[model samples]
Target: MEAPIKAPTPGAGGCGTVWWQSGTVYQIYPRSFQDSDGDGVGDLRGITARLDYLAWLGVDAVWISPFYRSPMADFGYDVADYCAVDPLFGTLADFDALISEAHRRKLKVILDFVPNHSSIAHPWFTESRASRMSAKRDWYIWRDPGPDGGPPNNWLSNFGGPAWTRDEATGQYYYHAFLPEQPDLNWRNPEVRAAMHDALRFWLARGVDGFRVDVIWHLIKDEGFRDNPQNPDFQPHQAGINRFHQVYSCDRPEVLDIIAGMRAVLRAYGERVLIGEIYLPIERLVTYYGPGLTGADLPFNFQLIQTPWRAEAVAALVAEYEAALPEGGWPNWVLGNHDQPRIAARVGEAQARIAAMLLLTLRGTPTLYYGDEIGLGHVPVPPERAQDPWGRNEPGHGRDPERTPMQWEDAPNAGFTAGTPWLPLTGDANRRNVDELRDDSRSILTLYRRLLSLRRDHSALSVGAWRGLALPSDLAAEVFAYERIADGETLRILLNFSNQGWSVPLDEGGPWQILLSTHSGRAGDRVERQLRLEPDEGVILGPPGR
Candidate 1:
């Protein structure tokens, strides 16, 4: 195995926090980030070419989405070979260079490890399907048909149909939580667990700092294959997955044992981090931390994405998450991802700036989605150009709008490729490209860089204790404020969610200066007594010395 990267020693300076806790993690959708070749698709070299930008932007790490060998059924989520990079992405040597270059630049590399399922074309699945008595037949979840000769049970696939697919030769059904092309692995099998653990070791041996395990909660299913209870609260507007309670299909208690095993493997690798992609409510979500915080280093808190964006609501959400964390469990936050809509599209550009401040100033780790820093909203995709399977399977809900190619420059195809882009580019790509935004003093990209720089400079912002500032009943609905304290330094972040100006009282004495502002050009303003804020603005305040 490659020698583990030595951990940074903690001290009163910014190094006091562990690497994962001290800085932001930026997620890159490889296929849309940059295309080095003229094939209209991004490759590993494309990502290698962007490491300098990430380091310059001040993010400490990058969490790349899956690029494993696959048939592209679910866009790399369906892994056909766990240990090899698909030729579409490049050779294994390209992956090694990515790791070496990222580490050389002092940036941690985290890969998306998809363990719940594999492409049906994978060798293991192919061998398992040869006949009912195939030694590997038990490697996947298979059962005889239900009494009616329909699906084994009522469990629905996340892609919008029965989760089971009949095997013509074997005279049985195999379960898949997503597309039928992707078959769920039988985690209950010891051999299956051993093989998947080996896959992780393969990457760790190559010097990856960590993994963001995909569908972590779906690792183990209910052994009985029972039908899920109906969700009474379901509505016509919700996705098909919400039609049931999902008790039998996923998030089973047994999954904790499986997680414990995975955690053990990561523990063997010095200071390696494990982040689980879980979408459970805060109550159940905290359980993923396992007893004494051994399950996942970070459970991927997505409450911010699902919560209503009102000031009072967001404050309460933060409070609940803080209270729900296990005693020693670390917290993390995410605003957008390849699977979700862009923050700018959900809330207008004015508030995307505030969202950036909120994410950075929060108590725990924050993950920034690529292009979100430049205020990229959903790029409308025409029906003929739609590429996402989810959008193709379900109309009006496709993620293609949010997964468009990144706008790097004003050149053809927004400088993402020399050939036709695999996806469409945003309408504002001409004016909002990174090359243009970098030089604009008041661009959202500048705001993001400023916020990140502040985190590195202030111990309080990077690893401080957080306390929500109390607001009077009326103002509470219109304003959200919080204080972060560490290293004898105190910093306050105040956000105005409303469109009108308001005056908020300073409970404590302060001749505080504005450290940064979302509207830009407001830095270094003195504040004392009641501070007046402009409409739709957010500001960070610190003692006057700086």
Candidate 2:
């Protein structure tokens, strides 16, 4: 097992630097992480039970997916109560205990705050739908039918079909950017903004360190409810939501103001973070940092998840993203999340090691998906066993594969649950589990532990200045190189993106020390001239000796 990591001394990197700036965050899908109840689903206590694992893994924080009261329509995304814990997960006291324990380990707790919409069963939504003139009627986005007696405009649900669902009782339609069960809140209403901000304060007062605001870009809609322009580049294979450019529906200029307001609420509690879940292009994404950096502390950078896994592609993406950041804005990176396919499945298993090195060494906060540390690939969910409403509504785009139960051991159900897992475990769970890999010197888990430890120990890797180095002429397309320097310390990361070995020439005159290698075969090796890299290998080099 990896040795446990002690909490960093206060202001270890710098006195004023935020914990998130130098610390790593791990995203845990609660239902898939662990199951203490033996009820086939993961819960708060289960996550608490695994706090040691996270602390040992050396992550600085835990960003738990939604565990609030819900009707399970979109799992916990369709929240019925922002303050109450879902019985499926645990109670409010259980969440308190989780926060207490996580803090004890010096791990920050970031809750998934779904502010874009609430479950249709939410008390506010229920009362809003009760009557057209009800006091809460304006809390949600309700619109009259179009002139042709059809639903409002050409808006489309992210899942499928119309974004508007007719309320037969009130003879009006309610808007839902995602599912009909998830009714979008009308942020145009001042009361709605106040209520949502209050929910944030509720958590902050309870010792929650921060929040990952869900669908933050979708908080506001165009006042005129105008039609989105048709996408000229629409492909038949793409989801229907992509048929139109989401111009009027989402990423409105007004959403930034809403995010700023939320940030202000978080600021009331010292040093708390507000991370916006925005998926816009890098140019637009930086705007969420606000015109004066008053918006989200970190607008999640998902370019790594979407970018092509090639040396040149990733290198260019990094350069573009770094160039686009607003002044004083902090950047964050994500490799895999609950929504996307696993990194192991995206790039082959060998390359995942390379990806891990890149993520940890990059000059930003890295949010790691739970199972990626052990190289968990996607698990195929059978048709009948599928649970994602999005997948059920639209065939073939299911996230169940990526959200499967974490493989902890080689037991039945992979030790995720005493009962049958809510979703299936990866096929190689027996061989590719935490217990099996923990002791393997060269295993991916060991690599992750070492990289995280190195990041913690070196200011250069934690809060350093990053610069992409020009690759040698012959190795330009196959290698991605970068140097990080901070506080008189410098480190170089070299990644081989190709499947063929290359003898990378070192012209900078470096007697380089291999600090860490993906293959676990090169640490402590001294390179006098050309450094030889095996296929799909990556290595971190210490500063040249005197």
Range of the 10 consecutive residues with the lowest summed lDDT in candidate 1: 1-10
RMSDs, each prediction? 4.7, 4.3
lDDT of model 2, residue 340: 89
Q: Which ten residues in a row have the lowest lDDT in candidate 2?
A: 1-10
Candidate 1 lDDT over 162-266, as tens digits, reads 899999988899999999999999999999999999999999999998999999999888889899999999999888888999999999999988898998998
Local accuracy of candidate 2 as per-residue lDDT tens digits, 149-245: 8898999999999999898998899999999999999998999999998999999999999999998999999999999999999998898899999
Clashes by residue pair, model 2: none
